[model samples]
Target: MAFIFESDLKAFLFCLLQFVIAIVVSYSFSNYTNPEQRKLEKVAMLELKVEQTEKDIEQLRDLTRSLEGKYQNIESVHVPLVAFHVYNPLHTNLEVGQVIVYQTVPLNEGNGYDRKTGIFTTPVTGLYQFSAHICNQDNAMFVYAIVLEGETIALSTQRDMPSSCNTVNALTVASAGQQVSVQGVHMSKSYQVIENPHRKNSFNGVLLHRT
Candidate 1:
């Protein structure tokens, strides 16, 4: 009876040792695998954040390029221009309603004024200021008109005198291709005269504002 009890105690201890070994191995494996799984999850989240940041940076670059292109286009199209000044020192004869053509050009920026035809053509739509100085050396009367598109807008008249000077100026809006000129009106004498270089009979036009 004593021998049987001793053997049963030995067998019980052996089974208890096996159960403790299984519990220790299970706890060690759980501890090691849990940390590795958490690390993998964190790595995945960081990679996703990095991808989102890259996409945001690309979008910003595209917007900047678009704005730069628009600025370049604006710079190419919007340019300011148009100015001219002409003079005539030689003597000229004109009949009724004849244009007083200038033969000398001091400054013609946009080439809007024609010396031979005595006319100015606008290059752009804008407000323009025009002026004319008429000098008569002869004793006869001299009269001139500033004409825009064949209509007299301003007039300058000088009576019979040894030396006479008359000036006329006008401010008006003009479109592209519109014509402006100075015309002579018939007085008691048939000739309209321009004196020497000192008299400086001149005509000038300038652009004030662009529409």
Candidate 2:
């Protein structure tokens, strides 16, 4: 009886050892067999993480600037006084020489932009940067001109289907009360058409350096 019991225990121990060996072999085949592939995957993942981190940092910086513009008075620091962001949800139809008016004004520091006139008048003499974004309706095309002091500095166009949006930015020197706006160009050409209401067509400006 004692011999039979010992024989049964040895058989059980042998089976256990075989099971452990099989598990270890399977693990090695899945992981260690393709070391280069695993290394490449790790590298790709790291690069993607780094790229996303950079974008997050940039977005945070932009938010910080926007917040500073919101809370701080223009005179609080000598940094800058003129800054604004405005968008339009009205007046999609347009004609030649018509100015684009953005009715909504979210950030207007130093009272530089007029939501009524669709123009930005500088509050302080400095170098200014202006941006205009246009969105065309599904079956139309619209062209816009970024006018600084009544001179076209930049132009952009958007079409109905394939390309539905475009943007134009301008950098110019101006003084207090100098006008900056977007206008129709008669096709140089430009004529405004109905714009997509779902898209936010925008005009924004910022004072870069004080002269």
Candidate 3:
């Protein structure tokens, strides 16, 4: 009976050792990760980086376009407004071949006009529009002309008409400091430009377009 109990004890100790070894192997295997799952995680990280890089490139392109627009605006030319209008309220006429000095100035932008000299000096080099209104009385024939630097550019003729008015216009390209004026011209004898209570002579100029 003692010999039988000794053999049973040895078999029980061997079985317990085998069970502990199997549990340790299973726990180690459960902790191990698959190689395919690691590769998939790396690929997902690369995809996120590529998406962020694409967004950065798009933002850079937008900034380039904005800079290009501002550069174009900087290269463009800027034009200014220049204009003047003057007229004499005196009830008397001006002398023939004499510059009409309009004393009462309603508008004189740029301060380029001189009322004492009856000249409108150009403030800038640009295209200019000039106009004049001439009035006469007592059936006196008179011719008026818009002069630029001693050259006539426009004219209006009154042929023996009593209390008549005529309007003349001139479009010219003028340089800075050039003078513009209205004068009576092409008359056999000296005549007067009429300005009375019934009529008023006017001279005006404006910068139509800048070049």
Listed per candidate, the RMSD to the true structure in angstroms reads 4.8, 24.0, 7.1
For candidate 3, write residues 6-87 as lDDT tens digits.
9888889889989999999887776665566788999999999999999999999999999999987764434566888888
**Quick one: RMSD of model 2?**
24.0
lDDT (Cα, tens digit) per residue for candidate 1, span 111-193: 99988788999988889999999887578777888889988888977875677778899999899899998888756565667
Give the best candidate by TM-score: 1
For candidate 3, the per-residue lDDT at 29 reads 71
List runs of model 1 lying over 4 Å from the truth.
1-79, 89-91
Q: What is the TM-score of each candidate against the true structure?
A: 0.68, 0.57, 0.61
lDDT by residue (tens digit), candidate 2, 136-190: 6664666779898888889976665643677888888888778888887653213
Query: After TM-score superposition, what is the CA distance of residue 26 in candidate 2 from its true location, in Å?
Result: 99
Q: Please list the C-alpha lDDT of all candidates, in the order they appear.
A: 0.84, 0.79, 0.81
Candidate 2's C-alpha runs over 4 A off are: 1-77, 160-163, 187-198
Residue 70 of model 3 has an lDDT of 91
Model number with the top lDDT: 1
- Cα displacement (angstroms), candidate 2, residue 73, comes to 21
Q: If both were scored by TM-score, which would come out higher, candidate 1 or candidate 2?
A: 1
* Predicted candidate 1, C-alpha RMSD: 4.8
